[model samples]
Target: MQNLDILTEDHYVLSAHIFEPRQNNRRILLINSATGVKQQIYFSFAQFFAEKGFTVITYDYRGIGLSKPNKMRGFPASMRIWGTKDYKALTSYIKTNFPGYHKFCLGHSVGALILGMNKDSEMFDEFIFVGTQNAFVGNLKLRTKIEAYLGFGIVQPLSTKLLGYFPASWFGLGESLPSGSAFDWRTLILNKKSTNKLLEKSDDFSRNLTQKVFVIRAEDDLWLTEKGVLSLLHNTYPDLKPTYRLIKTSESEKNEIGHINFFRSYNKKLWKIIFTRLEEGSHNVED
Candidate 1:
């Protein structure tokens, strides 16, 4: 694994890591992490793909992990910037470095939502969505909906106001995030249009994507819901062909593949499901 810094068009430096394969299959994978989630969470997953002859790249978005500013307070970063600039920069780096390789992107949670902001999303041959959805409160379960209302509607805003950033880790959501990024997260849950509401600020390409998307959701992920997942497909990315798979908790050896645990090394066996879809997608499955 080699660490690198990629500069976005706005001149912001993003911390990234590339896992090189000993044997090349000419296939490349770019992993976009969930909101406030660190790139290190994907190291094992990236290494596994690398051993399988697929070069994998993982990076932290601005105001996240290694890419964060010296102080969380007043940091200037948001999800919109993540897609419009940071994600775009990564794709540009991949295109310039691995021109002939078959490219695939694996987006986790908010990682998938940002696709609409950047036209470079079209460059990938296929996409893999893990634990992602519109995440509107109306699309969630009653219990989760209440929590969403309380947390995002009240707690998040209050904390962000006091700290100049959202302490996401305090809620077990992930790491702390810039205030703008935190507000965008709140917008996703509170806004009826969900992802489309966020896209209004940028060039909308959510419907332009026509690639096959492997959509994977964990059954026990309390924050995820079927209604939200379907809404994301039909509303935000209607043009993309989707093959859905509901991963039962029993499928996990530890019986735990929550929103984040799906990528954990303990769940390595489940990774094959992704490999099969990218390696050879002959099945149009909705499990």
Candidate 2:
């Protein structure tokens, strides 16, 4: 494992880690984290792939985890910047140092939504969408929709306004986020265009991607739904070819695979679904 600092084109430094495979398989996997989630959350998952001879890497977006600044207030980081600058920097590094390798990117939640913001996304041979969706309120379940209205519609904006940042941890939303990041997140739920609204504000390459994408949805992920997942694929990434897999709790060792826990060490066995799919697309790894 190697830890290093990568500087974005805008001169901001991002914290990153790389896990080298024991036997070089010429395959690389980049795990992009969800909103307010740290890269450390993917360490075990990355190591699992590394052990299987896939060079795996992880990094935190700005204002989250190691890439965060000492002061949270007024930090200028939005999800758009995550893809355009932070993610692009990582791709630049991989393309330059690991040329000729088959690159695969696993996008968790917001990680998947940001793909449209960067052109580097085109280089990946395939993409893995985990616990991600369009997240428009209209696509959510009844319970989740009401929660979204009360939270993102009221609490999120008020809290972000008061603190100049969002103290997301108070609500079990992981680390605190920069004010801009918080607002951008609200756009996903409250805006009629959902992710497309954010994409319009920045560079959009969603339609350009036609690679096969393996989509995984945890049955117990309250924030995810078939409607939401299909919305993302049809509305935001219309050009991509997606194969869906719905994982039931019974498949997990602990009978739990929520929005983030599928990548948890306890559910390591579930990683095989991804491995099998990537190894041979025709292997019928669908769950």
Candidate 3:
């Protein structure tokens, strides 16, 4: 694994790590992280893919994780910037450093959402979305929906207003998020139609994402529902239908494979499923 400091066109510096296999196969995989989640969370997964002979790269968006400013309270960052600038830079890095390789992406949650936000989806050979959803608060279960409203609707706004950032760490919610990203998420959750205007500005870039997409959902994930996942895919890629898989928990599996646990080493079965799908390079649906 090699650490890299990548600079975006906008001069924002992003921290990244690259895992290369002993024998290169001219195939590269990029792992886009979930919101407020560090790139390191995917390190073991990257190593697993690398052992399969595919080069892997993972990085944190600006103002998050290792790329965060020393004082994150007033740092400026937004979902748009994450898609347009941060991801664009990472894509460029891959194209320049690993030319002639078949590029694939594994996007988690907001990671998948940002892919639709960017105009460069054509650059990827395929996309694997894990626990990805539109995040409409109403789509959450009744209990989780109330939690979402309190956390994102009330706590986030109140915290950002008072501290200039959403200190998620204070509430054990992962990492603190920039005010811009927090506010943007709140707006999206509260007003669903806002995404339409955002998409219209993209000039149908999402539609241009013609490559095959594989969506994996965890049955026990409180944050996502099947309806929300389908809605997000339909809105983002109306022309092409993505292959979907819903993972069911088994008694043999000692650990719970929740939204975040899929990437952990304990979930070897799930990892094998993802690896097999990537190797097939086509939609192979399994219940």
Candidate 4:
């Protein structure tokens, strides 16, 4: 694995790590991290794909992980910037540095949500979305809805307003989030129309995106309910018609592969399924 700095067109420097395969397979995989999550969490998965003959790259979004600004308290970072600017930079880097490699993206949660925002999304050959959802609180499960209400409706506003940013780490909700990102998430969950507005550009991109998309969701994911995922796909990619799979707990020893556990080393069987499916490249419905 090689660690390097990626300079974006907007001038923000992002920290990234690359895993090169022993033999080039003419394919490259870019793993995008979920909201508030660092790229290092996907290291094992990057190495796994690398071992499978894929050149993989993982990087931290600005204001998060290694790419965080010197002054994080009032950093001007938002979800839109993450999708539009950060992802654009990463894709540009891939295209300029590794020409001729078939590009594939594996995104988790907000990572997948941002793909539609990329103007160059059509360049990718395939996409794998895990735990991606619309994030509307009402569409979530009862318990999750309650949690979302508290987090987005109450906690996020109060925290961001008081501290100039969201202290998510202090609340055990992953890393701290910038004020803009926290408010953006709050708006999406609190108002259904917010998601619609956010996805307008992505919807247009999806309508013309010919490449296949594979969506994977676990039954026990508290953060993303089945209804939420379906609504998200329908709204964002009404014309793309992506394939999907809902993994049952019985499929794994843990008996519950929630939002983030699917990539853990213990879930090797699940990984194998994903690898096989990617190799196949054909769409099949699986409920």
* Candidate 4 weakest ten by summed lDDT: 278-287
Full ranking by lDDT? 1, 2, 4, 3
What tens-digit string does per-residue lDDT give for candidate 3 at 1-287? 99999999999899999999998877899999988899989999999989989999999998899989999778889877888889889998887888777889999988887776676667887899998887777767889889888888788899899999888788776778899888877765665643444455444467777777889998778788997888787876665558999888672175476788788777866788778877787333211
Global lDDT of each candidate: 0.93, 0.93, 0.81, 0.82
Q: List, residue by residue over 165-270, the lDDT tens digit for candidate 2.
A: 9999999999999999999999999897999999999989999999899999999999999998999999999989999999999999999999999989999999
Error of 1 at 120 (Å): 0.8
lDDT of 4: 0.82
lDDT of 1 by residue, 1-287 (tens): 99999999999999999999999988899999999899999999999999989999999999999999999999998899999999999999998999977889999999999998988899888899999999899999999999999999999999999999999999988999999999999999999998999999888888789999999999999999999999999999999999999999999989999999999999999999999888784222211
Number of clashes found in candidate 1? 0
Q: Could you tell me every candidate's TM-score relative to the true structure?
A: 0.97, 0.97, 0.93, 0.93
Q: Give the TM-score of candidate 4.
A: 0.93
| Residue range 1-287, candidate 4, lDDT tens digits | 99988888789999999999998777888988988888888898889988998899999988899998877788998887888888889999998999977788888988877777787788887889898888888788888788888888887898799988889898767788889888877877887855566666343354556667788999888888777888877876665548889998888777868888887877767887777876776223211
Candidate 2 vs candidate 4: which has greater lDDT?
Answer: 2
Can you give the lDDT of residue 44 in candidate 4?
88
Q: Give candidate 4 misplaced runs (Cα > 4 Å).
A: 200-204, 282-287
- Which lDDT value does model 4 have at 220? 83
Worst 10 residues of 3 by lDDT: 194-203
